[model samples]
Target chain A: MRMSKIVRFSADVLFGAILIFGFYIILHGHLTPGGGFQGGAVVATGAALVIVAYSYEEVLHMIKKAGLMLQESAGLVMFAGVALIALGLGTTFFFNYLANSGLLFGMSVPFGPNPGELNTGGVLPLMNIAVGIEVWGGLAIVILYMLSGISKAEEA
Target chain B: MIETIIHVLVIAGLVVSAILVFHFRDLLAAALASALFSFLISLEFYILQAPDVAISQAAIGAGLTTAIFILAIRSTKRYEEDIP
Candidate 1:
């Protein structure tokens, strides 16, 4: 069942902020306490809030399961591809091949207590992003599936 | 110290909320109480200096889990059936 006007309005307002913060957590996973899993979970909560605020048909129009399934697959493939690339580079799997190599997200870190930059952590940021997207898709799919079941039962 | 007092208070509330969850005959109320329990535990995690665990718990434990429980209740019964 959809909520009242205030609830829907608040959900819409908070969705963007929550999504941005979730992305922040995912992007800065390497430099912050929150990583891919945490950020993705945060984003999923926001999705749930929005879903709950709207009718089932409205939700279905906004979010499709197939799209989310593809998102999940893409994230998993990206994670694996990043790991496998290390083998092609003649390094072990999950290698920090890009670290200190002056590429994107490869700025070398001096070992000390200091402010961290986004352009570091080699393959970590990519891996974080991959896992984040996968988790977001997986969790949101679960919520959608539940709502689907409810709608089905209601129809019967 | 202030920190110690805060920890005690949070834990106390956590225990109380847990008991309320068990005591509630209304499943919806129980689900909400569990969310409160989750929120308190997340606070405790933050107090214990584990923001990662805290964030995950707050999101999954409080948010997603509550949503799932509420949906389950909506599909079925809101009050627990007394088999006795």
Candidate 2:
């Protein structure tokens, strides 16, 4: 049976809030304690809440596995691409070539243990976003796929 | 003194919930107890100054795992079968 209206409404509200918070954690990884994996899992948890609130068929209509898989693949490719770019730049793998370049997300971190600047962390922030995307798609898909498999097994 | 008290209380709660998870005969109740255990552990992580671990635990351990377990339980029996 579908969840009650109150539960569904609360889930809907939480859904948006969780997505925003998760992205915030990812973007602020350099400045905060949370990073890609944690943020992505948090986002997937919100997706799981909405999925559990509705019937499998309804959830299937709302979220597509193909799209999630594509997102995951794209994230992996982008992460690798960024790493590879460092190599092409005559630097070592995963090198922070953009740091202190005064470019986007390339500002040098302040010396010592003071509060960090948002635009710092060079390749770290980019990698964090990429991993966040990958984990978000991968974990959500895992839950959806498991639920679908269980339901299908029950029907047999 | 207050910090110690809170730490003790959280640890006690963790122990209780973990025991309850195994003590319950109803599968659903056991799943909920496990969720409680997960939440308490996440709290412990937070108290230890690991917000990142706390967030992931709260999300994956307490949230996703509980939902998946509930869904799995819903597809089958709610009570444990006695071997005797």
Which candidate tops TM-score? 1
Give a tens-digit lDDT track for model 1, residues A1-156: 777999899999999999999999999999999999999999999999888778789998999999999999999999999999999999899998888989989898999987999999999999999999999999999998998899789778
Candidate topping DockQ: 1
Cα lDDT tens digits, model 1, B1-84, are 999999999999999999999999999899999999999999999999999999999999999999888777877878888888
Residue-wise C-alpha lDDT for candidate 2, range A25-89, written one tens digit per residue: 99998888899999988889889998888878889899999999999998899899999999999
Can you list the residue pairs that collide in candidate 2? none
Can you give the DockQ of every candidate in the order shown? 0.82, 0.79
Clashing pairs in 1: none
DockQ of 1: 0.82
Tell me how far the alpha carbon of residue A132 in candidate 2 is from the true structure, in angstroms, after superposition. Answer: 0.3
lDDT of 2 by residue, B1-70 (tens): 9999999999999999989998999998999899999999999999999999999999899989998997
Q: Candidate 1: list runs displaced more than 4 Å.
A: B81-84
